[model samples]
Target: MGLLVPVSVMAAPPSVGSVSISPDPAYTDTPLTATPSEDWYDEDGDPEGYVWRWQKYSTGISDWEDIADQTDNTLDSLYFIAGDQIKVICTPFDGVESGVDVEATITISNSLPTITGVTIAPDPASTASTLKATPQGWYDADGDLEGYVWRWQKYNTGILDWEDIADETDNTLDSSNFVLNDQIKVICTPFDGTDEGVPVEAVIVISVLDYSGSIDVKPGSDENPINLGSNGVIAVVIYTTDGFDATTVDVSTVKFGPSEAAPVHYAYEDVDEDGDTDLVLHFRTQEAGISAYDTSVTLTGETDSGTAFTGTDTIKIVPSKAKESVQGNEDAPGQNKEPGESATGKAIGKESAPGQNKEPGESATGKGKNK
Candidate 1:
């Protein structure tokens, strides 16, 4: 029968729903994956095979160019550069095309990260000063401003190498150990969890103030003791380092011996006349009798804008003795009598005793015994 030979017709081409892409926000020189939705179907209920094709939209040519072709349901190992556009097409067939061709397109937008304007505070630094670091004008495609990492480094004196400072992270640095003529620098870089951007750096040279000096007790030595009267005064002179200014020294820090002795008076002088001021401190002796006593002196403070200095010395104190006088005349030995004494060792006005003569020229006090 002619009615039994019915003809079988092919179905429409395959149709797919919206496409999905992993890592929607891509960065420079990175990978991206595109997946088709499960809503894809063919008019023939099922297709023998599925085809996936990828193409890149070229702005220069104002057209799309084929990039890859495969029979799988998904595509991978696709790298997109900055500002690149991608497109994917899917088709299903079972001896005949079914439904319409499914297509999806995505624009790849990626930019590189940048860091700039790394800075340090307090250009001239010291060991006692706190140095600060400041960075500016840094941004990335991810729009993360505070995602920057920091590190500090120091340059060896006279050496062409740099050393990384341990535990010196963030935007601050511990300049406590920095010495004169030391060179220091800081580096800042941007991090977006998966990648690191370019690095920016800044450097500064350090200058430290020195206040090294010594203290000296006058009229005293390591072996010899100082001689002072009952009420004597002690004199102390302090010598500072070549570049230190002694005039700004704080005299209150000068201590005499274990007991803190307040200086009776203090002055500055150019003892060596080298055009720099040196310190001089005067201290009144204690009521203790001077009999070879030990005196420890120390100077613990100096300078106003520089580092303070410390000096100490040990000294001895001795008492002064008066001279003894003899109660005798110039012509007599161990006696004070008038000139021309009698030979019998009696005064001229005294009466003669026993057989002794009482004459002024024949007295025992005379220049010589009577001939």
Candidate 2:
């Protein structure tokens, strides 16, 4: 042997044989733990400890990204979702150097989401207002919330049962589709990209909105006198106030007085001198059915948006001149005449001198006073 001398052999660095992730088909609801195989070999002895590195593959960037602050052996369920690729690398560490890296990966499976609450607004739904549905307490273990699926239903009075509204799938329902006293319902279903969750529902009854407005009878006249016997049209003005708009009133639906007479004509003007536009409508006086004894008048109508409105005002029913003329003619015959005067206000039978007594037949010159 060529100079056989005693030589010391150096031990190889620690080497990791294999690493595995528990629950191979990982789910979003469960935590994932990494385990290293005991088959790790080192000529010097067992390795001191292990070093772990976690990474997630991003489909958007098409690359592997290291997860920060995830050096631990366990990854919480909050970190991953369905279809996510999780990988963990384990390396055996000796006193001097770190050995070869071994890794294990698992694909996260889909999990169902849960919808805990559903509500509709505004709380008191009205025919003049739009109703909107809102989903609350949405829970998804996978941290993926795509959107919601909405379905609308109405309780059909004709059928006496709930029926689905055709093509009313939006979260917001317009007032035009429903009327007063209609029962409306909205169902909300939450879903991820892959699966849908449990559904929740909310319901409300449609009500008619009541709006109070100021109305002026006869436009400029504060007394608002009405002649029941007149054959002309009566004018009424609906004022636009801070809380109500007169222009929104439907002309065809306007009714005035106790007779509920419809408007024959309408126009827009600033009747109250408030600089705001007002609605003026005309109804037939005879058709209004306002009596001379009536002290007040009321106007009722619906808005263009289906809101109901009512207004009342004091009125003084004035006597008609035609009736006064008839009364004057009836009194002209014999009533209110002086003594011994004819219907024409002259002395009866003959012209009598002053202080002369008249017999049964008085002469014209009073010469035959007792003849």
Candidate 3:
């Protein structure tokens, strides 16, 4: 019966095939999922179980890694951070001639960025100011962020005389040169990954201003217009042609009265000062008779960012009349002469009349002879 002795055969472990990723091997701010393949029984028909690990590097690495220490099943659904280069492997139980292993090279790019906050800044500020701007923010753990840009616009034109004064596209505005009392506006646009991020606009809506200056013009300073009832009164035409420059003006958002003759000018020059001179002279109540009436006009400025930096000027108008305007030489020959009093003669026309009485040294016609 000793020859009848027999032995049973034991099974070998299952084999682990190649490991790789699906959809894509490289990811940029995205999660990665893996599929595994293995037989339940070993070469000898024994039961099998698997052990898995997510390896970032080979054996020489000082540390070993697993999805939740190999105890987790969410391995395929986990999110990967930027620049993560990894591999996956599976070992089958019921020991075999060789262990089963699956591996694929994975590289993850920059992930989605997070926008934390934003801001705006200006440069070269002054009594008459200009503005320029830029922005800032935050990011995510596994992801990275990129560059930025800002967009902007004008605020209101209803209150301002200067409409084209603001230029927010490049982010800039100037007010020193604009007529006073103008308002400026601005906003910011952030250039973020995937989509347009958030926006930051002006913290202060409008800039108001009050300046210091005083000037008085009497229209006729050069021997002025005179009115003596029928004779006339000597009215000095002294006056400030252009008033003192206004301060803190937002040029982009401004408006003017509807018409030149709207009756808003505060002063006039040579219209009614002299009875005869006023009657024969062209009655112009405006600047150089160009507009024919007293009026106001405006100009504006910007500092690059298009924000209202300086306050407005609110230009003041000066009122005037022919009686207060400038008069040539009234003492000349025919000036105010009774029709018969002087043949002071038509020879006494304004140019000839005044020149005839000039001292040889005061006459340009005598320049060569006098010298």
Candidate 4:
């Protein structure tokens, strides 16, 4: 009978009646003390009390943790914030026990601050990326923030990682001149001093790639071959990669005849109609050199983008030994006639006028003279 009682006692040990949280649904930053108690199966006539234990059952970890053993009745205080599960684990007088763990939720507020406006000087930040700028700006929220950071990308090729720049705390530019092709980024920083900040960064594109052009001269066989008298047209065409024109040539610098001297030349361009401007030389060569004078043409010019380019071109003017008056050929008509003989006729040929066929009765000069 004792053995049978032992078996029955083993079969029905204890069960938990109730376990309650002192305060349900915890709030953020609140502290709570949990106390757990259980009802016994042998409350009325059982000989021995049931064994009991307390455990902490959390959602993430895969093991049950014992908070209290059969010899102890310890209360645990839980301090939690937002989305934590609270469970009062207990061993009851009954062999069949139950746990009361409720899923709880709370609010979490992020007090992280944001960086606001950024201001730069000397020009629009985007106007020159490689510019030296004193970085300055404002921020949102009164929370403590340190400095800012940003990735400076050039032309979208990749990050200029080697160009790691410091966060600007105030408006003051460093002495470093920007690279010819460098761009800029304006980042606002606070004093917490870490590399990270709530950075308000603006991208600046530096645009100082200077482009320029000018004119040079080279004389073709037909170009300016005729001499320029004191005010004659020197006929100088300025040259570019594109083509040649006649405006930019300063004729005043051309020294002909004998003395090397500067000439005055003006430029006129039909650029509004077709293209850019060029210079030409117009001067009269003094009659000192009957032979064509060989020399160079010089141009003094400043580029469209402010570059100075001076170029000289070699040219030759064929000389005439003596100035001769050109007269029409008057003796060709009598070459084909015999001595002292007169012949008057019209031939049907290419040299004849239209509608005159040299018919049988037609006279050469509309007179009675015949062929």
Q: Can you tell me which runs of candidate 1 are displaced by over 4 Å? A: 1-3, 47-49, 68-79, 111-124, 127-207, 210-371
lDDT preference between candidates 2 and 4, better one: 2
CA lDDT of each candidate? 0.55, 0.71, 0.37, 0.35
The parts of candidate 4 lying over 4 Å away from their true place are 1-110, 124-142, 145-177, 187-198, 207-303, 306-371
lDDT per residue as tens, model 1, 1-371: 46677797856666677566656665544555667678866666665455667787878899998875443544443545656777777665445664445677766664556777788887655544577887777676545445668888889755788988888888887756476667888888866554577888999877644222246544112222344442434555565445555677767655554455666666555433345556666555552233355564454553565454555565555445420121112221101212232211332112222112112444432222111
- Give lDDT for model 1: 0.55
Q: Write the per-residue lDDT of candidate 2 for residues 1-371, one digit (tens) a residue.
A: 58888998866789878989988777889999999987877778854578888999999999889888998799988888788999999988877778899999888988777888889898666556688998988888777865788899999888898899888888999887787678999989998777888889999987644332367665333455666766666666677778678889889889888899997667676544456777767777778878878888888888898876667777777778753332122221121222233332222112322212222344324322211
lDDT string, candidate 4, 112-167, tens digits:
33445564454533222324434354342323354443333233337534344444
Best by lDDT: 2
lDDT of 1 at 166: 86
Weakest 10 consecutive residues of candidate 3 by summed lDDT: 275-284
Candidate 3 per-residue lDDT over residues 167-234, each given as its tens digit: 33565554543333333444555444544445555533334222211111111122222222223211
Q: How does candidate 2 score on lDDT? A: 0.71
Q: Candidate 1 clash total?
A: 16
**What's the CA error at residue 304 for candidate 4, in Å?**
2.8
- The TM-score, computed over Cα atoms with residue i paired to residue i, of candidate 1 is 0.38
TM-scores of all predicted structures: 0.38, 0.40, 0.36, 0.24
Q: Which candidate is the best by TM-score?
A: 2
